[model samples]
Target: MNRAWRTVFIALLTAGVVGSAAWLVFVSPVLGVREVRVVGNLDVSAGQIRQATGVADGKPLATVDAAEIEDRVARIRRIESVRVSRGWPGTLMIEVVERTPVAVLPVGGTFALVDRHGVVIEIKGVVPPALPVLRLDRPGPGDPATAAALAVVGALPEELSSRVAEVHAPSAETVSLRLRDGRSVVWGGSDRAADKARVLVTLLKRPADTYDVSSPDVVTVK
Candidate 1:
């Protein structure tokens, strides 16, 4: 019995030493990230992402929390979604999904980049020439006005999208369109959005200055 107890104690002591050594030598260093890989980024540079992430070359790979990296990267306004992962002993991988500018919103005198869902992603110095502006009052997330704006965006005809100057949501139920050609499209409300769009498209093909599609079936252009 004494011999058996001595053997067990020695085995336990040996395991503890081996575990500590492995943790100290292998796991501790791997806790810091040594390499970083950025993917799915455009307009924003890899260097910029790396800097924003604050993940340096010496960070322990195993110690790096994927959620922490994701949160850090997501702090940048242009990034919509991010994923972070560590590869084996030394590599840190970052995958980011960038937000594409869909429209511009008036921010005081300047403009802000709005996504297709009407999310104001970034405040910018100048509005991009290609994207149209969305003129809307401040609406919180999931507000009816925001829903109406998104509806109008979805209802817009592709042919007219480029020529649109702004989408005006003056009220929750009403939307008006300002065209690049100095014309207005009066869309009375969110009701029958697709119907209004179809009628508007047909009338746009004609030589008209102003269109009123408030009543979808009986649209008029002058």
Candidate 2:
């Protein structure tokens, strides 16, 4: 008799638990998102994010597609990666990873923001502060020269790079550097970038007028 009673109690308890879960999932629907929180956004604005998602407060939380939101965010240039999550009970979260702009090049009258990957990310209203101005005649979306330029920039010594205000690849025959300190560096080609960096460092110690590392082993002092 006691065994039968215990089994009945267990069945009742199971039913109650299932009913409560169903109520919470179907009737209550407390998992609906009410807000979206964004983080790590420097390029894309919150308004832009909301506009891209077409999701707003009061939208059904259960239907918030994180992957869809991420796809929309990816369409926006300068946003390298995006992640979305459901913040239960009233919030949807969108985290975006923005591509870092490495330099600014004058495309037309305005400046183009270029990333390390050599992709032009944006054209700003005004030139950003303290970024290198690349002046390659053939710097376009299709030019491998742009990638080479970025690689050269990446390889340059900090002291030399910070002193540089502009870089010019006149015809790919030579890569030139114009420094803020009234100096120039003739980095001939990208073949010996590290060696060129070292040579430039040594040349900088005395300061003639310019240091030519086009042939790093056989440097020219001007």
Candidate 3:
């Protein structure tokens, strides 16, 4: 073939290949989503995640927006975070991390399970045995007393936290813990929590009715 003719033929072949690939990826049903796979979710169901994605089956995979799907799924209050990814051929993958309750708060009639940030994760008819009761005038993300109580609880070691029955925070500066036993802990505030936790661990070894580690440097026991 002539040189100019060969060049034209090659150019046409390339264009045809690109166009066919684009059609298969963006328009043809061959590469469309057939299933939505949800993972890393326990409280939220796969059906709920799929519905939140708003992606219809048989829609071209390449045309799906992962960021938009993530934003939609994150709107579910129980979900702490969500990630969306496209699986090859015909699948959409959604991974979600649900909020975990750190404490329970008494509302009007029911108990609210709240996370470390004091955001209510769920409502329960009765308090769970594993979580401590948080005593505060108002329990919410915006409440300072709630914030202080959660901060103190979050700082406690797992072993120590399991013994805790209630967290009382009348104000931001006054936080205390009531152990499952009659023992009480004066936690003071959210500040120096790590130091207070370390100090309290040592103080608990001594038999005392009340342990004050609010000032970690100068602990008081009675």
- For this target, which candidate reaches the highest lDDT against the unseen true structure? 3
Name the regions of candidate 2 deviating beyond 4 angstroms: 1-28, 58-62, 88-90, 124-129, 170-173, 188-195, 214-218
Q: TM-score for all predictions? A: 0.74, 0.73, 0.92
- 1 or 3: which has the higher TM-score? 3
C-alpha lDDT (0 to 100) for residue 154 of candidate 1: 64
TM-score of 2: 0.73
Residue-wise lDDT of candidate 2 within 113-186, one digit each (tens)?
89877778989877786678998878876676666677778787777677778888765557788887778888
Q: Which stretches of model 1 miss by more than 4 angstroms?
A: 1-26, 30-32, 117-126, 139-147, 154-157, 188-199, 210-222
Per-residue lDDT of candidate 3, residues 1-222 (tens digit): 999999999999999999999999999989999999999989888888889999998999999999999999999989999888889999999999999999999998999999888888889999899899999987678999999999888988998999999999999999999999979999998999889988888889999999998888998999
Could you arrange the candidates by lDDT from highest to lowest? 3, 1, 2
Q: Lowest summed-lDDT stretch of 10 residues in model 3?
A: 134-143
